[model samples]
Structure formats: C-alpha cells, structure tokens
Target: MKTERPRVAIQGIRASFHEEAALRYFGENIETVECNSFKQTFEALQNKEADYVVMAIENSIAGSILPNYSLMMSYSFPVVGEVYVPIQLHLMALPGVRFDDVKYVTSHPIAIRQCIDFFDEYPRLQIVESNDTAACAKRIRDEQLTDTVAIANALAAQLYGLDVLERRIESNKLNFTRFLILTTHENARKKTGANKASLCFQVNNEVGALAKVLNIFAHENVNMSKIQSMPVLGKRNEYNFYVDIEWGETRQFDNAIKQILKYTHNFNILGEYLKYEEDTQAPKPAPSPESTKRYITVRKIE
Candidate 1:
C-alpha cells in the first residue's frame, strides 16, 4: 500500500530556500508549516506538530552550517534525506525603483558576502543584517522602504512582489546549497542501493584514538565524505566528531557502525538517508504547502 505524504516544517518565510527544499522533498501542495527560525522547525518536529523538518545544512560558499550540525547531534531527530538546490541570487527592491535610487541594501551577512561583487561599488551604502535574505525582502516590501534594496533570490522577489534590480549577483557562479530532511523516527533512509550514513562519535580525548576509530572504516572499504568536530558545550575541552560514510548495498555498514561504537562513547546514529540527487540526477519541482501537517520547532532566534 502507498503511504500518504507527510506534513513538514521548513524555516523562514514563503520564499526561503529552505521552503523550496521542503517542497522538493515532500511534493508541492503537501501540508507545510512556516517557521521563523531553525529552532522553531525543530520544536515543531519534536512536539509532533509536523511529520518532518527540512533545513539548510551547508552551502558551497559558506562552509558547514555549524548550528544545524550541533542540532542534529543534540536532538533526537534523525537525518533521513538530503536535497541540493542550485542558488541564484538576485538584487530586489520595491517595484519601479531604479538602482540609483537605492540608498540601503541588507541581507544575512553570509548572503552579503556571497554577492560581494555587486556591492563593492556601493560600499558607501549602509549594510544591515536581518535574520535572512527573504525576511529582509519581506521587510522592504511590508515597510515600503523605497530606497532600500535586498540581495535575495528571484523566488523571494516574485513572492514579495518586488522588482529584480540585479540578477545572478553571487560572486561564484556555482552557488549551491545542501539541505537535510529530518524525522523523529529511525530508519528514515530505508535500505535502497547505494546510500550514505551519518554517524557521530566521541573518543576518550586521547591522541590517535580518533584515527583508530576511523581505521575501522578503512578496513571495511567505506568511503568518507566529511569530518568535523564541535565543542561539546559545558563538557570542557571535549568535542564531538561527525562523519559521513559511503557504503554500497551491503550489511557491512551496520556491522562497521556497530563495531565503531565500542571504540567511542556517545556513539549515535545520526541518520541513514538517501541522496535525492545521487540517484535521480535531476531536480524535483516543489510541492504546494500542506496545511494539515504536524510540526515541532528546535531553535528560535529572536
């Protein structure tokens, strides 16, 4: 029997990239809840207000989204799926406004940096920080800030009824963002041929202990994708290491993870999710919002 599509929560407003990722995974028109922050999305998922949460985990230009990684390991929610979106930034302002009329431009700091080329000539223009690029666009539209412009996406401009003052303004042409699809339950990445597994571990803070644990994967012929450490807050000098491993359709993945657990403490299974792009090699169109979806929020920044 086919299971019904699940309601999901995504951070940011209607035109946010996170929302686009959610739509791509869940299908457009499925129930969705908009969150003001990543934490709020986590809360919706944890409280069972929504069936799943989708969030940006990393960007090609911006490095890893540390907070999301920390959230992944801290929260009980498991990483189930991943979606990659090609990012094309646009400069927007109230309709009918010319570029010379612009007095201010704002966005998330990371976003401003991503499109530095478009901004360099107007360094004299005040740069302000908003929660995000889309949120900034919404503010400009809502307040009718005629002199103010924003660096965001075309979708944001379209949704907010703003005019694109500039196009593809990102410094890098290959801008793409990677987002994760998360769930409260395990086995989100049910066995499909050729999958990736995310796992966390904490060695005894001894020299070479970390490498020894990784050796297990080497012996098993598993491919490693990423490795990073986060300071275990309040735990003094102790940091947790996150790893992504590539394994073929074989039971050895489970066996290897199980064995690695013995060598480290806090050995947790982050998620065993399938990469949508890896198999399809094509992008999926976003689904419409699901009003009936349940949700839980994990983070909220005021």
Candidate 2:
C-alpha cells in the first residue's frame, strides 16, 4: 500500500493567503512548503522540489502582478488550476497596545494600497514594505515593538500572537486575490469539458488588424471571457494580446487557432484551465461573476 500526498510550493510565509489557496487545492493537512519570492516558487517547480506552485497574479484592488506574468509567459509550466481567495486585511500590533501607540505599519505593497483608506486616517503614520504580511506580523511580535503594527490577514495575526487593532481594513468590502496553480509537466492540462483557452500573439498594426484577430474566435463560436493587451519587449510598435476563450470539449477550437497562426506573429498557447467555484454556492460550466482572469506578467529577459 502507498500513501499519496500533495507537495505544494507557495510564495509567502506559512500563514499567508497563498498557503490557504494551496490548501484549498491540495487539502488542509497538505505537505506545504514556502518560498520567499515568486521567482523562487517557479524555480522550486523547475527544480522538481514541488509538484505545484501557487502565487497571487492579481488583486481586485491593485491590478495585475506584472513580474509574475513575465515568468508565466517565458516559463513553460502549464497552469493546472486556479483559486480565488477573498482577502480580509487586518492591522495587528503587540498585545495590550492601543492604536495610538502605532507609529509605523508594514505589509506587502498591494496590501498597503488595499488598506490605504485606513492609513490615510492616520496621516502621521509611516508605511514600510515587506514581502509577506504574515512575516511582518511575526517580526513585529518577535521584536516586541508596541509602536509598530502590521497589515495582514487575521490568521497571520493569530500565528504571530498579536492583537488585532483593526480588521477588514481594505477599501473594498468585496476584495479578493486570484492565484494560479502551475505544474512542471507541459502536457498536464485541464481535462474538464468547460475549459478556458489562453493564447497570446502579436498582430500587425494595419487597418482593422485587431478586429481581424478577434474575428477568428467570433467565427469559431468560442465565447471570449477576457482579453488584455501588453507591449512586446524589445520590439517597437509590436504588442501581444492575451485572450481567454470559453469552450467545451465538443466545440472545435483548433480551427480558430489555425486561422490565428496564419496571421499572428510569435503566437503562443498559455493553457486550457478548468474554471470552478461560482458564487460560493455551485460550480457550473457557464461564466461566473468572479471568473474573469487577467494574470500574465511580462518582464525583460535577463
């Protein structure tokens, strides 16, 4: 008999939301490991140290995680799954300390932006940046700095044994973070019928050029969920468009792709991912309110 387990690598500290997202995919008692940086998480998967990599691609408030998108585009790790976790930002400080005692707060830049309204209330407070919010809370507690506080999740505050000065400090009440689960295998793509096909390409800037590109999907009857455009580095007046189209197994998507390749330059296939969890009530094949993805980062190749 053999016992099976999931080896998941996530970027951030133990109590970060990425860990929670990995657990949602792998399970609670999952064999979890942490990498300090997003690139390191990708490296761990490339090195075969972990089966999967989970990291935030976009926030409802702060927009796309650009650097990670570059990694996604160049790296060959296929997206195995996706997860969306509602973010509840919290401000935690040393035990028994009042809010007035806080001088500076530390957290990830996105977290800081999400809770800008709260920070704005304390105009004199200093803001510091950290890679992970949970790690900042742990540092605040370990250093025993009552004047210092951290913006992170409630779970992080609990793990660091700090007092919550404020909860749900984000400007938007419905804020959430979306993460992508990547695997090392190139052939390991989604198997479900209702899948999303992601592809990118550079189109000539002639008259009606962009329309001609989209017409391929329109003619194939592939319902596009989202489309985003970014500049192609090192190439002037050239750009890449990332497209996600919803398709069923019975629906033929190859013809549309064939038409695209005949015209587009450096056309690349991102992945076909199975979308899940709609409204936290049911999982359906049709479009979900929160299922639009805009996560592809591009950076200079060094």
Candidate 3:
C-alpha cells in the first residue's frame, strides 16, 4: 500500500535545519507545518495538525537539548526515526553590505554560541538572539536591514536571497545536529528493521542497582552508545535514565531488555528505530559540553 505524504511539524521556517532534516528523511513531497517553538511543534502533533515532527535532540557542538528530552517524556510521542545533518552555519546579510557595515549579528542562541570564536574577533558587532536561524535571515531580508547579519545554514541564505558574508563560521568544524522523527504510537509500531533503541527507566535509590542494569546489556553485548540521567523533579537524588543502545542481534537486545526490567523500576522503551548513518567522512572531535556552561545569551528584538 502506498503511504500518504506526512504533514511534518518543524521548528522554524522552511529553510531552517529542522525542515532540511525533515526533507532529508521524509523526502520532498511531505507537507511542512512550520512552528515557532519546539513546544509548539509537539502541540501540532498532539492536536493532529501534523502527522510527524522533526525535532533536534542534540548537536555535536552544543551537546544534548535537555528540554527536548523532557518534552518527549511529557508528550509521550514515539520516535519513529532519526537523522543527522551536517551543520554549516554561514554569516549572511543583505546585498552590498560589508563586514564592517554589519553592526548586529543575530541567530538562534545556540547558533550564535557555536560561532563564538568568530564573534570574538569582531568585538564591535553586537550579538542578538532570535527564535530560529532561518527566521533571522528572513527578518534581515524582509525588513531590508543592511546593518544586521544572520548566522544560519546555506539554505537560509538562498531562500532569503541574502549574500553569504562568511561561510562555515561555526567554531567547531564537525558541527552536526541529530533530529528525532516522531509520530503517534500507532504509526511508530508499524515501522520495521530497527537496530537501535531509546529507553527511559528509574532505579531504586540503592548502591549497585544501576550497575546491575548496565551489566545486563554488557552481558548481552549490546553497545550502549549514550546514557543520560535527568533528575526527577520533586524527587531528590532519584533520576530518570535515558539510554540509547545499538544491537547487531535483535535476540540479544531483547534478552538484555528482559533482564534489565528485572533490575529497574518503571522502565519504558521510548523508541526502536534504525540508527542514523552519515557519509564516509569522519567527524573531527569537538570539545565536550560537560565542562562548559551550556547556556547562551539572547537579546530578543522588540
């Protein structure tokens, strides 16, 4: 049976990375429902305004988008797939504007922080923050603001007819963002060939409880790619673990989950999907965000 093109909800305008990621995964025929915020993107799905949503869960440079994980846990949306897009942030502005003429640099706060080194050299330029990188470019083009430049993807420059003042200005050359493809439980259950799984669980506040759970996966030989602990609000010292594991043998992964359940409490399998595979190009190692302050400054335009 031929599947109908899905209505994809994405954060930001059509040229944003979220939209590009969606197209890369769902193809060109899918209809896009642009949302101004990530929360709104989930609301679109919940309200049946969209069939699926493309949400950025993490970035190589910025690390995990923690709030998004909370959103997933709250909305209970099933992750149907995943995509990793190479992020190339460019400095762009209206035509005829030179580097010296630019007084204000604006982009999504995360985008601005990724290019911090580039901005550090230009101390005179005041940095501003916007909700979306593509929207920043759109504002400069729509308002004919020559003094303001936007840091966004090449697609944003093309779509907004802005000139690229500088290309690949991000401090980290290996910058890439991973997006989660989400759908309702009914649609997600119909997916097949999943080799990776995302899970959430809680363990008793006792020594060796968590270790026992980890040992099960180790015994089963399932590669645990990522594990994050989010503190359960109002419950001191108790955390909800979010884990991602990849398995070559489905039977082994199944057995590991079965064994893990015996040691953990309130275990929830968030999703099972095919792992995202990039091209043969190797990524350069970037600084881990654990030591650095993840927060960025933002100045909204009135």
Error of 3 at 299 (Å): 27
Candidate 1, residue 217: the lDDT equals 85
For 1-302, candidate 1 gives per-residue lDDT tens digits of 11255667788766678776776666555555678778888888777777788989888888888998887866778888888888878899998888887888889888888888878977778888888888899999899999899988766777678888778988898988988888877425464664787888789877888888789888887878888789898999798888888877567686788778778998887878675664674666432223213322223323
Residue-by-residue lDDT tens digits, candidate 3, 1-302: 21366778888776789877876786556667888788988888887777788999888877898999899999999887888888989999999999888899999998999999999999999999988999999899899998999999877777678899899998889878889999887667734768898999999999899999889999999999999899998999999999999999889889999899888887888889888876532332321223111221111111
lDDT of 3: 0.83
Better of 2 and 3 by TM-score: 3
Question: Looking at candidate 1, what is the lDDT of residue 26?
Answer: 62
Q: Could you give me the TM-score of model 2 versus the true structure?
A: 0.84
1-302 per-residue lDDT for model 2 (tens digits) = 11245557777766688876775565544555578788888887787666678878777777777777678887768876777788888889988999887789999888898888888888989999988888898898778988888998766776667888888898998987888888877427566664676677888988888888788878888778767778888978888787767765535587788887877888887777777565642322211112211111112111
Off by over 4 Å in 1: 1-5, 186-191, 278-281, 285-302
Q: Pick the candidate with the highest TM-score.
A: 3
Instruction: Compute the lDDT of residue 152 as modeled in candidate 2.
Output: 84
Model 3: runs farther than 4 Å from truth?
1-3, 279-302
TM-score of each: 0.86, 0.84, 0.89
